[model samples]
Target: MVKDQGLSIVHVCQSMDLVDSVVRRWIKQHEAELEGQPGIGKPLTAEQQRIRQLEAENRQLRADNDPIKKSLGLLCARTEMTYRLIHQLQQKAVPVQQACRVLAVSRAGYYQHRRRGERKADVVASVQLKAAFVASGKSYGSRRLCRALQAQGVIIGRYRVRRLMREAAVRPVWKRKFIHTTDSRHALPVADNVLDRQFDVAAPNRAWVSDITYVRTRQGWLYLAAVMDLFSRKVVGWAMAPTMPAELVASALCMALQQRQPPRGLLLHSDRGSQYASLGYQALLEQHGIVCSMSRKGNCWDNAVMERFFLNLKMERVWQRDYANHGEAQRDIADYIVSFYNCTRLHSTLGYLPPAAYEQKMAAILPIGVSENT
Candidate 1:
């Protein structure tokens, strides 16, 4: 009314008895809504309506043309994919020339790419198998190898994996049996089995298990004392020597204490061996404010976690070697513990994670102490 009919705001407000600002605000609010309406409003002209129709048609045409625009790129990528497929088929006894001709590719290119792809595949498979074997401590058979490869998105059958293993000459480590003897004939006082079989712990440094295992060398016997945290199953400390004495166990405990610096009143669980129950070992534990928890007399099941670790250490690394002397045995065992077991070897108890990784992962989420490797 104001623009088209040339009406005055003052005359409208006088006729309606309304404030000037209120009438102006009402006109401003309805100005957009009244556009393009008939009679009391202005509508789009024919040229403007034609442009809007053209824009709608343009959008529809572009959407319809999109698939055709991408078809050329798709065709080129498909040809390369087909070339690789033909190469793989040729390796399985398909005629390379016929496959190349049928796929509409050059026979020379097919042969060249096939050779390159095969060499690349062989190298890739060799590396993958070797990594899988080393990660498994060379303990995986073809079934495990196939599963490991498949987990990494490498689709390979077990029989094919077996052939690759044979070609690579990477055989699984054979298991060897051994015995661990604990001397419980001492007259030293034995603590009650406080830890018992409770392998689960709420936090690190709350409880630890220790044990002594012997390794036979050409020069003499090498003994290893290990301390494991119950929470993460990490070997927090270890000591290796040619003799199994109270100092051997004390040295391992000292290494654990110096590395972890765990809080006081930590429970130390072990078999009732004289080394663990000797005065020196007891006094050392007392000095660190650590308590003692002994396993039952001659009961190996009471300390099963430590026993399992020793079993893995022997079967995976020790039993496969012929150490010439204690030095060789100590060096190899230390490598297995530091380089492989604590850092690389997967533990089923820790959900297939190495103990160090498991502890670090737990430490990130839980309010627990961090464990250190030997």
Candidate 2:
């Protein structure tokens, strides 16, 4: 009812269409006036009010989580809080079944975690354990792993990390033995044992040792030959093949040659295997001006450095695991030799220092110009 047209009865519409048109025109006129004014409507509905409250609560929860962002430990603490709250509520009259359901936990798990914070300790132990594990190539059990940690200045109970490793299914890699890979019977010229088990070196590439090992695979067997620097015990070069041949060992020797351009008079040592006895391999040493050193005809002990390397590979890594195929063995062996064994695995012979560490120290202190022939 418009008070502006107080004599309203005089201008009334007679038909429905006219009445509708006049009503619309009046609404349009009022809409313009209402644009800057408060809207005429009922207050918020119950559902609308609940939705607004939920939004505010959500914002507050976000603020609460800000302090613990991306921290699993913080998230775990929150979970524990919920569990504790539910437990307390049950003690104070809530039903047991209801409490467990609301807490989102099994009663046993909640109590177990409370009694032993394994998750937190496990995470920390795992980082340490991994270094030791890789360093030892999974050969060391919890006991040896514990000793390794002690040597590194870490103080933690063996059983504690053992339990965590068990829970995480952490186990040292498996190794196994292989025999009959060596063949020294071929009618080829054998070099003299010039170094004569003298494995110690005054500098890099002074004495290089080479050897062969076999790995079993589904396709059959694979052979790997490696050349190591006696100074660092590093696998300076290695080659893999399904068959034993001169070329196989030659390729590995070539890699060592290219890498170390070792000075003339560098002693190249190996077991009296046919591959090492071959003309191709000897020619390589002669061309590079290297002195050839071979093991005594039937004695493995003559080439002690090569023997020790194989023993470590066998007992510490190979003898502990079974490979489904050659490729897997190759990859794991490569990772062990280059990534862990030489670089970081502690050696008792080197005063528990890793090969790389020992080499770095030697390189820093040793004076230059100490040639091998000197």
TM-scores for every candidate against the unseen true structure? 0.62, 0.58
Poorest 10 consecutive residues of model 1 by lDDT?
365-374
| Model 2, span 1-374: residue lDDT tens | 44465434324544332575655566565675678754444479999999999999999988977665546455577667766777678689997567777545677776676557656666777788887776675666777677688877877788976976787677865545657878888888888889888877778888899988887667778888999888877778888888989899999999878876778878888988898888888888889888998989788887777677777776776666677887888887787788777886667667767788888887788777753234
Provide the RMSD of all predictions against the true structure, rounded to 1 decimal.
18.2, 20.6
Give lDDT tens digits, candidate 1, residues 1-374: 56768889998788888899877776766775577433333468999999999999999988987776567466677656778789688889999788877666888886677688778887898899899988877776787677777768997788879888999998877676566657899899999999979999878888999999999889978899999889888888999998888999999999989888988889899999999989999999899888899999989899999998998888788888899999999899889888888887666677767789888887688743344221
Q: What is the lDDT of every predicted structure here?
A: 0.84, 0.76
Model 2 misplaced stretches (Cα beyond 4 Å) = 1-131, 141-152, 155-176, 319-322, 371-374
Who wins the TM-score comparison?
Answer: 1
On lDDT, the leading prediction is 1
Looking at candidate 2, the ten consecutive residues that score lowest on lDDT are 8-17
Residue 310 Cα positional deviation in candidate 2, in Å, after optimal superposition: 2.4
Candidate 1 stretches with Cα past 4 Å from truth are 1-127, 141-171, 177-180, 367-374
